[model samples]
Target: MMVRFRPTILRQYLLQGQLPTTGCLRSQARLPCIAARNRGAYLLSYAPVRAIHSESTPTASNGPADPAFVPLRKLLKDEAKKQKLSGKKKKKNANNQVVEGWELTVGIEIHAQLNTAKKLFSGATTSFNDHPNTHVAYFDLAIPGSQPVFQKETLIPALRAALALNCDIQQVSTFDRKHYFHWDQPSGYQITQYYEPFARNGVITLQARDGIAVEDGEGISVGIKQIQMEQDTAKTLAQLDNVHWVDFNRVGVPLIEIITLPEIHHPATAAALVKKVQVLLRAVDACVSGMEAGGLRADVNVSVRRSDDPSAPLGQRTEIKNLSSFKAVEDAIIAERDRQIAVLESGGTIASETRGWSIGSTETRRLRGKEGEVDYRYMPDPDLAPIVIGEDLVQHLRETMGELPDAEVDGLIEDFKLTPKDARSLVGLNSGMGVEYFWNVVDALKHRLGSSSLADNLPCYQLAANWILHEFGKLWFDEHEDDAARDFGFTEDGQCARVPVDHLADILFFLYRSQITSRIAKEILWAVFRGRVPAEYASVRDVIDTEDLWFRELSDAEYAALADEAVKGQESVVRVFMEKQEKYPQGKLMFLVGRMMRLGPEERIDPRSAERVMRERIEERYIPRLRGE
Candidate 1:
């Protein structure tokens, strides 16, 4: 049925959060008529929404303007508030399951240093590791006579990042000075984009691999509120000697702050979203380094709400500032949620504030009360002109920005026929460099090791995925995580522990050709990882040849002789193994083969091949002769 809603009814329904979000609520009329897929078949809009729900206050004359929405408002108003406050919530660590109690809603605000050599509004260079105040200019120090000049080159990578996230670029966006008082920001105000953010309404969907711990983890698309350009403050060092020092080197450095909507329901989801953003930005060369380097950081807003009532208002939220790592992000949200739950259980109301996560305390430390928009006293900057992005520039950037992470993920699944989990795992490595390295190795194998035909490339893809993700990735992230990037690297400079891609390819090729046993390959792997092999032996083949780590299948007579030779020291063990082989086959047989394996000076036999040979000898020859069959 077509619903005819008067302008007053439409306005009241929207203000009371009873209507679905359609699009931007603008000053002008939306359209003469629009198709309503969920609400109704056809809906009419004759007037514009002057402001959003929170922007305009409800007056006395507006007492239940829509009779249909009044019952829902009254029904959920009290119970949802209580559910947010006084119930015990059940969670299994970031799962999206519907708990009987309160639930969490989190949003992320990420500020990343742009990958530019120079400052945003000056000619001074931007350096992270240089001496204090060496890269500063007069304007960076807030000189009286200095003026800001915008750099056009900073927009190249920034636009590439925005477009990579599928954001719609604004044709004209202006700048505003946000007033604040801080020791690091010597200028009384920092320039920002308040009223107009250039890139809006983008999305980053948490991939399948990210949600292996969560229920219904696929396609959780976190909406992007906006992406705005801004300047960074100088570094402030709070010394242990009770003195404060400021370095102006980072002053006026280019920064892009990406604001996300509160669509995240769990701490793990928020971490996944931030990681997705990092990989996306790094893939575009927008932000070169990661959160560990302080090149990108996230501020999360956390709130607890009742899961039973969908129409209930969100609970009081607190902002957790400067969460540097993804694990820190997850831990902060869990900490804040537990804190709010405790406050409500004690008959105390939660307050809005800004907090910081302390790694030592494993909790969120209270920073200050949250600031409102009016506290900033925002105003337009008179010196800078409005940024007008041309259509031609947007087109050029779109053409050269390369394939985005989302598309690349889909391609990996469809083209390579890999599992969705494997595809996302490949993309998440080293901020999207894992997929690049995978392709490089796959291409090398296709040409050098395997046949070039498409039918024969399955082995190449499977081999690359297994070794990179299982072997190299495990060592890269787990055991050698501290120095793996530099020591066992996937970086541009191949100055690692001699386990670069080419050397790894050589090792995999040797194993693929069946010239070396998996154990010997592992020996080579650990040798490369631990730098045990001398640098003089360049390739893995050289090390393998020098160490005599080759595989050879022995004949039946040789296997029988080896088994008889191994029986000398293990006669009692062989009798026990014959008695226990039928019941427990796991450890009994391998014990005999292990003795035979150590009989040689070098590793010349594959353990798997030797186990097969010994098992057959025990079953067909040794068992029958012992039993007189």
Candidate 2:
């Protein structure tokens, strides 16, 4: 069976040309088309006339496919036949190819945990702890008939995020019920917005590989479809024994889901977009600090088709879920792209499905059925009132917007004169540390350098960026590390291990301007990690400083003991210095210095005193005698 499509309404004879009887229609060629309704429109009627010679049907090939492919040619033919008989007008792309080659579409949706005191619809305290079920509220447990109450704290921050993204803040928005059944979700439905989200149409900028900063531009617009408040689901813990437990402490936590259109084209762009948004959110104190702790998460929707076909309706879209890091997101997209292109090459249909991100191999595996809007069962929440945002409220929040990551990166580059690489590292590290911590580090350095515009000082910014990225801040991935024990620590009471920003600021300044080497700075941070006073110089600084100042502390006796040992074996040097006192020899003085330096602690003389005494001896004896000649 073969399915064929016509190119234009006026070109009905084009179908005749596509038939096998004509020499123009190659046996190996495949065409895609839509059926027209009017008399002059295209037709989809199949006629099977036995051919004189047996030949294989042609498949779409933008490139070579995988060897293990089974062409699903029968499926496509059957679907095309069915659509024709049903009298349904088919809508196909004007072009036959699917993937876009030249132009790339890119967008991002940042799922940020709100900085709310309580859950969005419940009064449960939203805090991090290692304990299980400590933060679970009755509403979160979805105990049969628990009613939801609304909080303004969650909404305020969502608007703040929308404003930061430069989104169109709607004056009114409502909540909906997004239904999905999972172990984590105690409530069958998630409270979110569908009809009217808080905001729409926003833009974000990211630094590309070429050092060129690109905003989600015209073809790459990151259209923010909606920014809706939602409650987080519980965390699930599965043991090696096959027992699964639910930690509801994370349930009902206030969160905002920022959904974006399918605009991303390249993996690198996707990564940069996610990172930029994450940085901005953290800088504004709009989201939680950690990605693994479910403070931030994302779902990437990807489709691939041939470059020639701009309108060849995109290939089946795949949703890659629960990608916590920017790297993971990029990997998932690459893996999916490979999978989709391979399916097409091998004569197989790309399945619309959801896949899980495997960080270890950076591959995606099929999880379940396809993702669609119908799955969420979105509807308005009856308990909560529609949000009424006033101009005054927007203006009040606007005043709070300080320097975001984009503006700061520009400032760092122009004012501080930092290289792109250095600025990115500093911002990356700073994002991991909360907003207050980052500012404190910058401010403390200014105080130390005694320059009001220290960030603008080239030397000061370079030193500060180095300390923040490599010296003081060490990223912790314990939240991602799997445990084999009884307790699940992703609860409200879980004590998240964070680098204390203020103390970290103190450490950066202490290392800067000091004579401490990079190696010594690492030691100082290690001591701080062990709960020692970060400012305590004796523990860390004393080790290296004591070694450096050893020669300065030497006494007369100590110097004599070392000098006596140094000259014993090298009597030739002494004799030469005396005879050639014709100018006390240069190598002889160097020999004495090297000999004194090599002496062990017990035998070594103080460096300064040894030099002083040696100089005095040379002046009193060698110089006078040499001048006499």
Candidate 3:
């Protein structure tokens, strides 16, 4: 069915004019009448504004006003009405489900916890993993008689994060109060941006397997609606059997809320968008960006409607929250879409509400209905002054933003001449490289081997990459063995062993460049790691370390006795060399040289050099026919 929105509402839908989101702005903007007719509908008329003699102080909990709206609200309400009407007359689909190939419109709101040394308003530390409540200050805890003092350090990271996402920075922006009630929130309402966000009109470029893709621009532009700095609520932990504990340590931590337009369609795209944002956040060093740690959280809004009907508006959307994992987020969206479709097919009305995903059941369970917007009762924070972004601040932040993950990955591929797949694997290696140290280790190995040209040799690079990730990684991170017992104990995973880069380079050079067998080099490496002398030594730590070399510990008297005995016993094998110089060559006499080298377990002889010396001596003394000729 065709539906038309009133001029004011349509203006907001097209984003033609900015709407007042604050309670103060909402009261001044007059409401308009919404008219709907079947099959084809147009705006019949809008209610004229009734001018009041004098204005009254706006209260926080002002009930719904008559025909009330600014632009965005009017558009949202008109669209909601159209969706509600379409649901009543919509035909039932098969399997009591929304038909396959149903068009789904997706949008994302990403909240990143800003990385900082201190809380937004308090001097308490913002670092993670501290003892619970250790980082809380009076303001952070929302203690009685406490006032907030805004921190510039908090805002700097948000700006950097927005820039990393390829967002346009707004020169002018303001904050508002977002209201709700919870024990975790000691503050009645959160100070956020309802007027002007710090970042807007940003586009993110992400590379999927197929080609380069932008989150916005395809259909919805997934355009960045806004990014604002706010404070985080306290963490709540619920244990077994209905016991709950609140950790106020995280309260008032600085955070960034990034809202996207309705553009994303596929589940993979949603996951990709999340991952891309994660990279940018980590690159900026703002917010830990670790999913397990809840440094970042995403709320997904999904709506499924018929592609066949252009006139019919979008279906009612369910807001799915608490989706911490990428897989969970996608699954929740799909499940919610299916649930909405099922409700429509069963001839039931779908209510607009917030829902939580139950991963165990693979369903979106409703948490709340179209609830009234509680008055956060926003007013200018008297305790804190407004932040002004100066040219130097912007310039400094721009420099700190650094290259984002996608750009860095591209550099790795271009600079190292890595294949696309290899580059991707490396970028995603070890849950994605979060710091420079990981990349440095790989580069150090590459440089040491002088294998710069061998990067295109993927098999060789893979071999090297794996060893660093596994062997070196194991030394620090692997808990199976404690290195305190071992000679070298590098406390952290990144610092595996202090084995110099040049030393490793020499070992690899011997194996690959000098053509030493890998087996022999490995033996040498083992001795080096154990702090043993070169294998030419006979004894180590008062033990015969190996049978190969045996003369180091023994005195001069023992070497003399063994050499005399070897000279007497090997004359028989030496006699044959004189009789048949034509039949027995160096190859045949090498066996006898091997025998003499093993004669003294106390002798430390270079095996190859000794064999050459023995052959030359035998040829000179015993080969009579060849010598005379």
Candidate lDDT scores, in order, read: 0.73, 0.61, 0.60
lDDT of model 2 at position 254: 80
Model 2 CA deviation exceeding 4 Å by range: 1-109, 209-221, 430-457, 473-629
CA lDDT of 557 in candidate 2? 61
* Model 1 quality (TM-score): 0.75
Q: Model 3 compared with the native: what TM-score?
A: 0.61
Worst 10 residues of 3 by lDDT: 46-55
Q: Residue by residue across 405-523, what tens digits does model 1's lDDT show?
A: 77888888877787877887887776676777787777667767547754566765677777877887555656444663434555532223346666667777878777887777777
* Predicted structure with the largest lDDT when compared to the true one: 1
Clashes of 2: 17
In model 3, the clashing pairs are 31-67, 115-287, 216-221, 217-221, 550-602, 551-602
Poorest stretch of ten by lDDT in candidate 2: 45-54
Report clash pairs, candidate 1.
Answer: none
The window of 10 residues in a row where model 1 has the poorest summed lDDT is 31-40
lDDT of 3 at 622: 48
Q: Please write out the lDDT profile of model 2 over residues 1-629, one tens digit for every residue.
A: 23232332112233233343444433433322222344324343222211101133322321122235433456446656777788875432222112444333334556788888888888878866634555556688777788888887777777788887778888988888888876567567888777888788777544452222244232343556667777887766542233344556678888877877776667666776776677777766688765756689988887777777688776777787888876677667766776777777789887878778755332489998885788777777887789898989889888987767666666667776777666666555535343234456567667666777754555655665666555543423234333432121221221213334444545555545444434445655555554454344444335446545222245666666666677666656666766763565776787786777677352234445567766555556545655574
Q: Name the lDDT value of residue 320 in candidate 1.
A: 94
